[model samples]
Target: MRNSIARRSLLKKTLTGLGCAAVMLLSPLSLQIAHAAAPEKDELKLGFIKLTDMAPLAIAYEKGYFEDEGLYVTLEAQANWKVLLDRVITGELDGAHMLAGQPLGATIGFGTKADVVTAFSMDLNGNGITVSNAVWEEMKKHVPMENGKPVHPIKADALKPVIEQYKAQGKPFNLGMVFPVSTHNYELRYWLAAGGINPGYYAPAKGDIAGTLSADALLSVTPPPQMPSTMEAGTIDGYCVGEPWNQQAVFKGIGVPVITDYEIWKNNPEKVFGVSKAWAEANPETHKRLIKALIRAAMWLDENNNANRQEAVDILSRPEYVGADAKVIANSMTGTFEYEKGDKREVPDFNVFFRYNATYPYYSDAIWYLTQMRRWGQVGEAKPDSWYFDVAKQVYLPEIYKSAAAELVAEGKAKAEDFPPASDDGFRAPTNEFIDGLTYDGRQPNAYINQFKIGLKPDSLL
Candidate 1:
């Protein structure tokens, strides 16, 4: 781990050449994540998309979290989410900052056939849907405004009238999401549907993965980094993406961010750190150590009312990290977010990586992804509630997270109170923070699914 940390640090220094800025901010006594111990693999490679949520992996490597555990890591930016998952599957990369559904979808053969697992969730609520300034102006008429601001939790209800205008005029209303199984895709769909807009569906059984079945707005996959270009090219009107792409839109003067997922559903789960299940089984101790470092990194990220966010924005701006311009990344990396060109608002929970147990690999989080898959017809078939649990168990490795947190507590690097009780069940208690105000109990997935007006029904199939 020491060698890996040292090597990653050197690589970051070479890539960033960031000068006194990095040196001045290097944390003292703040980087220790675990007791010095033997690491199974000294040199490792990890994969990531160029999104801001990838911060934990970057910070863990740059801050020497891997070294404290005696591991050396290489962070590589993948071209796309699928490529990142493939790299992990083919052992081209050791692990990746992954989509929460990538591991579960892979495990169930929904997209790619492989066994993937996640021990750590990377972040929460770093995603937003943005429209071009032109579109925002038109949609503004339908949106309810009060106190000189758009109402809280802006729904696609406002966008529906705008899309209708395009449709009535025989123009296409195109939108982009990062990937089919990405949280961005599901969140965008959920937002669009809550307002009576059909974003479309997938019918894997019918050999249609384009997800354009009976859609009003055409949804397509655009890599996170390409979202701005795609939108600016008039190829896509808007997109749902993670920072700094949303922030990039504002900086480029090309678009306006309407609402963040945090506003859609408070503190919603986002990305996860995923690896092939085979890799996890082959290096159990190493996997636990990796999760420990990530958990610590997440804790540092959200600590002290996000006091570290400014420094974090600078780190993410470095070419070796998120690599966007500092101002672009800082648009949201700091506590405030940019909506319209100048409507900046304070939204501290927009990128919660750790606080509120955000880093914990809760079974409920995995279950939510499965529900989305079914909702969009990616599942194609329905199963009992237990199937949701069984699938969630396959991808979300909370046991690994618990073991790592326990080790940290034993070493006094972390406290027992920082984690759920040792006897803790994997599921969180029921939650009702959804846009529709429907409660969700992970244990009763069937009942939860029934609450949705949109999506697959029991025993339904394409």
Candidate 2:
């Protein structure tokens, strides 16, 4: 493993030098208008989990966008997020569809200490929290109802009393999330915290990464595909996971989805197209080409107000891709998320791909993940606001995204208006668009951290 890493490091330096030389040779006008150089590595293997949000990658490959860039790409479905991220770090896969937190966490040495970065965010708002039928039945008594149906954007307060009941009976209330640093985990924690429930903390300084200190509810890791089965088998009472899995629970008649991450934070960033920094440095042109193809794929996914979503659903249902039943994937992919068996509602933004600049990886998105990491105890020490900015700048590469978008615009493939302005500082404007109604200004990360009622505030140790 050391030798392999050493080899990648050497190749990265060589490629970096070559890229710098090529840039130096170009005139200012040429630098401004030039398309990407020919790919250094064209035949690439990319990894993704069996989830509907991996649509951008599948669409890129299936629609020949990759081939259009003189690249031959193979898309493989990994067993889980760990396998997918590990394969990318090892160079076994050039890149992968990753959790938004994966690259940030890896860069900060949270779980795996590796320099991972993302230039393209795949999709947004594709996750939902679902509880087993037994839990939902108990929770429904406390949920506000209108016309014999549970209210939308159900709060975790409804589940809080149920957890208390389990505690009273001397039973542990277990909830599953995909990974510790996953959006699922943070979203679950956010929902629980919003309702005044203690979701626990991680004391990594003391080697307790379980995140269960002073906990009312215990959260654990379960891969996306196994969530429904895990809940059905009575291991976990509920789970927070990405598409098809949450919908799978409803289809299997084992669970009912309570709320979506959209309800938690509107238009929240979800999956990203991530590669090792070594791999990215070693394959700059190939990386840019890859982003271009994915950007095109994202445009296709959200074209004409999702007119092409049915086709996207068809492609994502193949055995090589998500491999779920088409109807199950379509339950959320095509715009309506089924909460209860028949309580489907129109959540048009439930799965956003290209619209709202979803593909542009903003620094604010990276900092949001870091804030959550700090809010929980994954980040053991408090850092200055500049530290958060520096870390986000390291992991989220909006410059590369702009390069890809510029190339597309030069080629008449995408419009300039569809992207953020060149003047965008990569920090989104502050807004109180959360289920808890607390404002988040990415520029003021510590203040945002302080706004939370249940998380560890600045300088607070577990």
Candidate 3:
């Protein structure tokens, strides 16, 4: 088996090198435009958790997109988010897949004070909140039904009665999210708060980062892959996690996914490809090539309306990658999601990678995460709108993303129309697509934070 694997690996690398050579020979002008600068560092080790959104990294590695830009990347599966971030900070890993909020959170000294930054948004709308079988049984009683099946976008309102029952019985209602600064934590909080449940706050200023102060539902950290087994062991009643784990619950008959982040906030930013600011500055050419490779991978994932998702599922199922059954990964990756055991529904944008310009590192996306941090008290205090914008601009580097997209366009690997325009200003148009129906304008982040009913109020501290 070792010899066979080595032979195949050698063959794959040889073919990849030949492919790059062919591209250069066929289009010398394109090569000149794309590779104006040789990568500052050619070999890299990138980190990721075993989730589907890591697909871009996997696709780039597997599809030779990385080598196409003179990058040799080794994608490593991280034990958890903290370990992943720590490794990146220490320079043990060149970069890694990260939560959309991670770079911003680190920059603002929320969890760990580090100058992390991201030019590539890995994916969008790939997470769901799941409940244990018992919780789902009780929640079903309150959920609206259509034709004897549970209605879609099941709000946390249905979950409220169940929590009340737990409270009346004096049983502690516990839930799990991947990390405090993760999209999972914020989405779970957003959903609960929208339904009048206090998911609680983080008074990091007081050294109480537990985030469960006066909470109806106490949410703690559970790594993505462990979400299913951890809930099955009865340690957590439910969890909000990214793909394969949520579907794994359904496959194991242990839990039911209630609502995806897509319902909580449509096309919400999920993960990002992040590196330290020092690494990016020292290796600017290599950084752009990394982003260029990721951009190509994302385009392929969403190309032709996700025509390549099944193949992506196959790639992700490898033991070195997500290591989940293809069936479980496909449950969400193939344009549909399973709620109940058999209640699969069409949700084409469930795991978007490239569509809707998903790879663009928008400052509005960064500000939204910051708003969540402030709302949950992780930021500890209110600041001027200028502070939010400055933090966002510092962490989410749109200029790097645009430079990469420009390279791809020049090389004919992607189109000029495939990226945000030069005048995008890094903010998405103001949107009210949240579950609570509150408007959020990135330009007016403090105003957006004040509109929340269950979060920290203006000038309030825990």
Candidate 4:
């Protein structure tokens, strides 16, 4: 009987140990569940520039998506990209709709030395390059016309001779981009370089950040809302910017948009939702929840073949948001773009928010921006492929994005198929859809940079 009692005591201890092991196994899930609870901070303020691509932020606020996530968000419009980024860095704003390049630029000390991170990519492909009427009239002479209309995807080759004439007359062919590190600057530079015109360079190492060191066409900053008027006043001959400023130019008859960035680089990533790294770290749960709400907002924007775009346009027309006329904003927002007066074309993918996995913050997207920075001398030195990968990983938090997306899927707010494939390594397939017809694989940034006939070479420095 004593032996039987000892065996029973041993079995009891073994079962208790197994129970303890099970609890340890389940502990991680419990912690994750706790992290997904109510946000640490709910009432928030977000900033954005007054551009149509800022639609996702507006949609999230107006559609009650933030409220659904228990976030009371105040959406404010900053005067320009610089102020918006500065405000976020100073913690005056919780986050902001930022240039896809902003977080990368800030982190790398291009403009500001701040550790900023983006968990969400806002939208893609909503920008155009426009020239004043006189420049367009001059360019028309060189452009090939078919049946009384200039051919589509008007190459900057036609603009080359015009710049030459300006040089001949001792006139500076001045152009404008939104900011130094903006996509507008790079796209304008890319288009000009493709056509054999040197847009310029930046030598931060030499204390010359003007970016016009040896430029054939001088490029400078002009805020989006002022693009049309600046060109109209002859302060700038042309400008590259996002809508509805480009469309506003068409409506106001100040200039004509020659090429969309969609043509420059098809479906290119645009803006992102950026917060200071400190802010993100301090409020991890809030950041994830905010991303979830933004994802739902992006889905709503692109839903039903963009049947909701008109509503978005209406909402954006309010003075507090984009503040442009509804008609001008609709010119590009509703799947059509007016290039020249009376020349409307169907460009359904002109402003993609969610489709094509546009909302996913791909490392490939970040790498492409870094490549442009190096090509333009903003980086001032060549970096290895692994360096680009490291910077991209540091700025873009795909783990946070995935967790947010997973929650949406579990709650039936989104489908698993709607996101990047579970196996995606954050790199997009190589694409050659640029107007220059050169292929770019983010994995091979150096090779891609070397292919450019213009801009700084890997071995060449200012």
Candidate 5:
């Protein structure tokens, strides 16, 4: 790995030197426009997990968007989310493709206390909940069928009876999520709780971070890439994870994906491009340039009505990136998702990168994650709505995102219409698109938390 990184560095420097020399001769005005500001740190290493949503980083590197911005970036796949976050905090990694909740979780001292911030929201709605074959068989019995096919958006209601049976049989029902603060964890818990199953709670104040207090189904962290095999090994009955892993389960015939996060909440934000607060402070220009490159990559991913998805799948399938089979990655990337075997369905928004202003780091997106953290007892005490807003503003740097996006629009690389309006505030309009049909107004996070039937209510202590 070290040798390969060295070679990549050498090649990037050689190519960048040659490209700069050629561009300098064309026009001084053009050169001034192109070279943003000799990057504070041109050569940098960014980290990612081997999930399909890491496409922005991969696409940025592969399409030379990084080079276009005078940034020499090496995309290194990390062992897992924790390692990836730790590296970014410790300055071993300049930045990383991170879970949207990671920065919030880290900043609030959920797992690791660090001042991590994100200027780029990576993608939206790219995860699914999968159950092992045995659980699927049992769930199939309860699931509503239409024309001999299981209905769409298979609710956790179908999995409730299975958990009951596991308890009756003296078997501990186990489920997996990528990380404690991951959207997968919250989405899985949300689905399970909506169906009247107690997924569990956290009591950090009591020094019990296990998150399995009085639970019907035991939830644990499993790395994204190992989710399928972990289930195959009988360690977890089901899992909520991002794409390719859920699809891998279908291909391996070990499990069946029941529903996607998109079905749970429409166009939900997933991952972000994250850096330490200190890193962003020191490399403001570099950070803006990085976001600029990522914005372009995101537009490319969803451009022309997803005409480039096939190419993205191919690029992601390479060993250096996602390393999954092209067919498995394509199962969800190309505007469709496979549920049960041969149950291919059109889910055009499954892996959104740029459409619907997905890349913008909305403050509402940050607040939603904070609400989930509080709902599950990660935040031991209740916080005011003002506190939520302050934390969201602190962690999600939309000004940086807006600056990068405005530059893109000014350069004619992107359209003003493609972005959120200049007068728009950082919050999206209140949405009630969740599966349970609960309305979420970022301005009223505490009220939203109080509405959840499960989870810790306001003034309720774990």
Candidate 6:
């Protein structure tokens, strides 16, 4: 009887210990389930170019936003925009920091015939055009001056004389932008053509994609991070690129940033977060969660009248991030922009993220890029405005954004007052802030295109 009791007691103790062990092992997981944390697709690899707008990714990782949702993310720096896009399409990267026009261009089959989409816009107004000191010295002659300072929103007409000089010398006045399909390319071309500089054309019908057809100033491709290097090598006279590259030029004292894209088109959309359609489809919840983190990061970047800008600039300067000098990053980030040495100007909108409804991907913004592509013959055949609408729908995912935004409100991570009302339309109010005095209404895109003195209109395709 004694042996029986001892054995039973021992068995009872062992079983109790096993139950306790099970409870301990499963408690954390049960809490994860109870909270409905992010899924088994927790391990991720995201890519970014070395630019300030890549801040969301950096901030999310640094602040453990990804971890809060039970994700372990690896952020990689891409070689170039093309390589980055290719990686996203081929599933080499789960997603990436993409040019505003990349998904639009890719979806329309202009460059790579991939079905890419963006639900999150990374930033706004973070790019600028910079010229070598030598080029600027000559261009300064034509630039309008006030109080001994060059009047800003300086038109490319100022550079026309310099290009003429280059032409007279039997040399091409070369410039650089990150990609041919990039907003920098379009903005640079728009600014030049607006100034009667003839940025030239792309005659893909003739197998010429150099975009220098009938060109006054020849624009070529230079990777964003390499813009300063190529210009410093004297390979190109000037370049249009995003920050801190423009600021990088200033720091090296090799080039001077002439104007920012904010001044190009005030509060314009810049970079976006792009994922393959398949990834978004299979991982809808994870995708929404990712957007939530990014949206919070965007808000944080712009909160308190941009009080966090210095902190963000420091984050961007880290060697693993943008890897540029902090001063270079601050030239634009700190809300004061330096043109020539000691000729600093206050530019409050140099790097907008959450403010001005920037993170929302407007259908009209997508359409504007489409119009530029069509204007330059990227879209070879003329289609109705409905085609523009349909293509814009495919590329920009405002519906997905609405879902994520609505969820953020429901979860109380963000206030209902922070975003547009549930009945809010995708279009921003008509903007008259363009440098050239053109008004843009997202609803009337084609009419706005028609207003342009240059560029292909509805009737001018042939």
Candidate 1 vs candidate 5, lDDT winner: 5
TM-score of each: 0.92, 0.92, 0.95, 0.92, 0.96, 0.91
| Local accuracy of candidate 3 as per-residue lDDT tens digits, 40-154 | 8987889999999999998898788887777777778899999999999999999999998888889999888999999999998999999999999999999999899998878
lDDT of 4 by residue, 8-87 (tens): 44644664578756546656644454346768897788999999999988888777777667576778889899999999
Put down candidate 6 lDDT per residue, 1-462, tens digits, no spaces: 234334544644664578656546666645444357446476678999999889999888777666655456778899899999999999999999999889988887767888998888888888889999999999999999999989888998898888889989999999999897898999998888778787877766667778777788888999888999899899999999988898788878899999888887988888899998888888887787788788888888889998998998898898778999898899888898888878888998888888877788778888878888877767766667888888888888877888888877766678777776777666678888876878877676677778877666755543
| C-alpha lDDT values of all predictions | 0.85, 0.91, 0.91, 0.91, 0.93, 0.82
lDDT of candidate model 6 versus the reference: 0.82
| Backbone clash pairs in model 3 (N, Cα, C under 3 Å; residues 3+ apart or in different chains), count | 0
Best by lDDT: 5
User: Better model by TM-score, 1 or 6?
Assistant: 1
Tens-digit lDDT string for candidate 1 (1-462): 346556666765563586556546656543333224445676789998888999998788778787667567878889999889989999999999998889888988888999999989888888999998889899888888888788767889899999999999999899999889989899999899888898888998889999989898999999999999889999999999999999888888999899999877788999999888888888887888898888888888878888888888888887777789988887787778988778889987888888778888999999988888888898888888989999998888888999899878876778788888888788888888878788888888878777777766756777
Candidate 2, pairs of clashing residues: none
How displaced is residue 353 in candidate 3, in Å?
0.4
Candidate number that wins on lDDT, 1 or 2: 2
Off by over 4 Å in 3: 1-27, 30-35
Residue pairs in collision within model 4? none
Q: Whole-model lDDT for model 1 versus the true structure?
A: 0.85
lDDT of 2: 0.91
Model 2, position 297, has a per-residue lDDT of: 96
TM-score of 2: 0.92
Tell how far residue 95 is off in model 6, in angstroms. 0.4
